[model samples]
Target: MASAVLYGPLFLQLPADLVLYLCREHLRPASAAALSLTCKSLFVLVFAGTRPGFNGGTQRRDLQLLLEKDLGHAPLPRRRVLLGSGFSIGYRSVRLAMNRHFLGAPNGLPLRYFDVQGISLGPLRWFEKWSARILQGELFLSARRTMCGSAWTDEALRAALDHEGPRYDICGHVSMSGPWSISNVTALHSAAVSASTSARAPVVLVPCRDLVEACGRCLTDYTTTVERRVRPVQGGGVDGRQTMEYWFITITSFHRLGSGRSPWDAKWQAFGGRPSISTIRLRRDMETHPPGAVKAAWDEGEQAAVSGHRRSHSSPTWRAC
Candidate 1:
């Protein structure tokens, strides 16, 4: 019998159409990446199209249409808001839009803000029917575990907090099972500030309250503490440089039961319980500072920094409930 012949270099000379077919039919993303490194000829042939077998202009157009069609039928991102009492308020289909200013702001600031324009809330089953829409553009969702411990410890939550992406909102659902305390609320405020600083985006916290009696207290305390913490400062900089203002966080509370209903009203009512909803607007009086005073304070801070001792500012103090 004749010895088997091997054509090493000749294999790379295979028809481009055949190579494209093999890659499209057999290769997964990982496999395709590996195949791209096999040889220059195969690489060119395999990747000739933007997507597999889409090299020609007509073919590319057809592929683009197919992608659009598939995406049109894709499911929108849905988030489940569960209360600590084992009752689910419902899933929200987030509808976000770019806003010139923060929600309810008088004028647009230099920073970017994406408003949570509206949210579709209803029975869990209702979300299934509206699966075709894309609810979020570039957003992150953090849901706390109801069993025990804090939500800040979750890895995904931490990463989302630290992400340095374009202004993307961080929406969090916090459910507390244990007794609510000032400490828990403080931790949450700190986490929101950290996330706002890291992502340069506003955070919207939606807390699920199980304690009907403590709902009002929690809302007041949490809102007040966060407002004070994120309040605009007149000064505090090194070497006379202007201090950049930090982003603000918005805390949305749902009304337990009343003549007025929030978007989530139906869902909360379905669970046979009233939920607390409050809109606490941050006082604008503390929102701005006199330019002259701000400049003077920074100059003073610079003088202090130049001296032997540097001044240390304390964290915002809050009264415990």
Candidate 2:
């Protein structure tokens, strides 16, 4: 009776064809499905949890659960297979949030919004230097993801992290990891290569070509990524050691800001202003720019369609949507 009354004629008459078309059109995405998933999942979670008379804090808790438990923060296959499932590759939710707060605190108090050094927060937090945030905070820049914003909760940081960082695989593609900064990945690879007692082929990230300097007025950043792969020659080298050839391979990517208080206000979409939901939309829009490398690292198989548009921060072009 409740179902019939609630989802009555209005629900039935909702045009299944239109819904099917929308689902088919949207769900057919191949790359950076994370971005799409972020928006859709967040909407569903928030909407479902925040409905009228629903538990007030349930939404935040649900998002936190999504951050800590579901995504594994930075999941790894080795841990799952060897250490069993739910093993911690890294629990990055808090670290990402702290980093976001530091980056986003344009007008924040010292310890209130950010205090990685614990100069204002605590001695231990200061001692740790917030290394996790530093790793996930600033790297993985592209046109779609910006350098900074004013959101630093678990879910919001997860959404931002989804846009930043290059995705990587583990265990010969048996498992997956990432949305990690290229620089961080490169540094780790370099360290492993240096410290290795045995000769192992490690995947190293570097620029395949010169950085394409299309900064797009400081909004759309462009970068490239090339992986350093080593192959051993079956034949021996001069000293009976294996001769290796270095191959540079490429990775593909397909992946924010703002305030708008009054609907008509010109600076509505700009960040750090009166809060508006469109501000969230604008930031999300900014984060959609194929949020990974460009050119040499991602040249093959044509480019993905650039979806959504951002209101330019510059005065000449930014305008009401």
Best by lDDT: 1
For candidate 1, write residues 206-253 as lDDT tens digits: 233322111322111112112212232357544554443232223322
Give lDDT per model, in order.
Answer: 0.30, 0.29
lDDT per residue, candidate 2, 138-248, as tens digits?
Answer: 211111111111223333433332343333221111111233322222212345334543456433322354333222211222333433444555687556767543433
The best candidate in terms of TM-score: 1
Model 1: colliding residue pairs: 253-277, 254-276, 254-277, 255-275, 255-276, 255-277, 256-275, 256-276
Candidate 2: lDDT of 153? 34
